[model samples]
Target: MLVLPALFDEANKLRRLTVEVMQRLDAAGIDSALPDLPGCNESRQPLDAQSLDHWRACAMAAAAHFSATHVLTLRGGVLAAPPEMPGWNYAPVAGRQVLRSMLRARTIAAREAGREETIEALQQLGRREGVELAGWPLGAKLFAQLEDAAPQPDSAQVEIDQGTIGGGGLWLRAEPDEAPEQADTLAAAVAMGISTV
Candidate 1:
């Protein structure tokens, strides 16, 4: 299985959870890989230079490279799943919602700083010279690509929700931390879903 991570904070905050899930999967004899997408991780390619289509293509290539039979997506990572591969989604999110939240925060900050940054201007700037949105350098194509992108429709796969695992959303925590319980729960859910196949 190929483990596709969520964007930004959702991905960073769940780093420990990903590690925990991987350990559990290993114990269950379910092998998986968490490959870094192009322009992400240690890649020299600047984030703003990458288009969403490029990421999608990279995902498909990674799946092939790993010879993965299934994908395990977390949150907005659902957008990267290759259609040909079967997969499971956990807390899928729409990219548009995420972008909107980022833009809103940026707009609010600009207002307080007495800067005139409108959404349209930012969109235009992003398309022209790459703009930083919520700390991520977004290329115009990528920003436009995600504007209407929703989670890939359920494709005969499983979707797990760890909300009841307690302590609210781990991604929302002010400080970085781990949710061992949630990780275990997620691992079990993943294992169970894979077992059915």
Candidate 2:
């Protein structure tokens, strides 16, 4: 089976750790591939125009690259079982929690920047992401735990349970009001998860 990663957060800040994990997995002869989605790293596109359907198409293409079955850890609750594909399972990882956190960070950044337009845009983004970022501190806190969430499990090869294993600290594209460094760091972290270098 191919171990696909979560879209946005998969390669965010934890690039090194991600590569290390993949290397170990490959050495053990375990099959896996981190398909690049539209608007993500190395995929030529902007996040502003991406849609759920676009992501599904990218995933389908990735699945086609491999003859065996594919497993995806998708956020935004966007992944659905493909009728044409055999042996596919929908692992609904903690999408709601992640979305909530993303909204919080984005909305806060917009508010700080004094940009009403940006704030509205982020609110819309939050809605599409399927989780409200308004006043969900508890959920936000859980998501914040990703701040220190390790890219690799302590054992270096934790198995996916239920729907998640070591995926939590995702730094989504920040609002225009936010700092680019934060977003860059996040993107790097996610890349580490998919990297074999």
Candidate 3:
């Protein structure tokens, strides 16, 4: 299985949950790989130079490199999941929704600091040059791509509902957290899904 994590701050919040799910998958005798996106984690690539197309290419490369037969995309990660692969998208989200949340956060921060920032203005700036949201330096191309990016419709990909996990998503939390039961349930769900495939 190739696991693609949620983007931005949600990625930070879901790291532990992702790991927990991977660990459970390992215990279930399923192998998994979580490759770092080009501009994320330990990668030396500059975030400002990356676009959605680049990320999608990198994801396809990772899938091929890992010889993965299945993929699991979390939240905004769904936007980059390889369309040809059989997989599950856990609580899929559109790229614009992800960016809007970050943009709103930035606006709030600006207001708190006695500066005014509107979403429209920020989006205009983002579309022109780029904008740093929640510390991620997004390029104009990437920002523009995200503005209209949605998950590709693929019959091979199954959507995993949050309700199936029996709780609010980990991404909804303000900080990183662990939910052992959620991990257990999610892993079991994936295991079952793979078994039937």
Most lDDT-accurate candidate: 3
Best-fitting candidate, scored by TM-score: 3
**Which is the winner by TM-score between candidate 1 and candidate 2?**
1
Q: Which whole-number lDDT from 0 to 100 does residue 89 have in model 3?
A: 92
Backbone N/Cα/C clashes per model: 0, 18, 0
What clash pairs does model 3 have? Answer: none
lDDT of every model, 2 decimals: 0.78, 0.42, 0.92
* Candidate 2 lDDT over residue span 1-197, tens digit each: 34444535434533443444445545555465765656556877755455544565666676677753534343322242243443222223344455545565666766688965354465444444422334332222223332223222232222333223333333233321233343333333334443542
Query: Judged by lDDT against the true structure, how good is candidate 3?
Result: 0.92
Ranking by lDDT: 3, 1, 2
lDDT of 3 at 118: 98
Cα lDDT tens digits for candidate 1, 132-154? 87788887778777777777565
Model 3 residue runs over 4 Å out of place are: none
How well is each residue in 1-197 modelled by candidate 3, as lDDT tens digits?
99999998999999999999999999999999998888887789998999999999999999999999999999998888888899899999998999999999999999999999999999999999999998999999999999999987754789888998998899999878989999999999999999998
Stretches off by above 4 angstroms in model 1 are 127-129, 154-156, 164-167
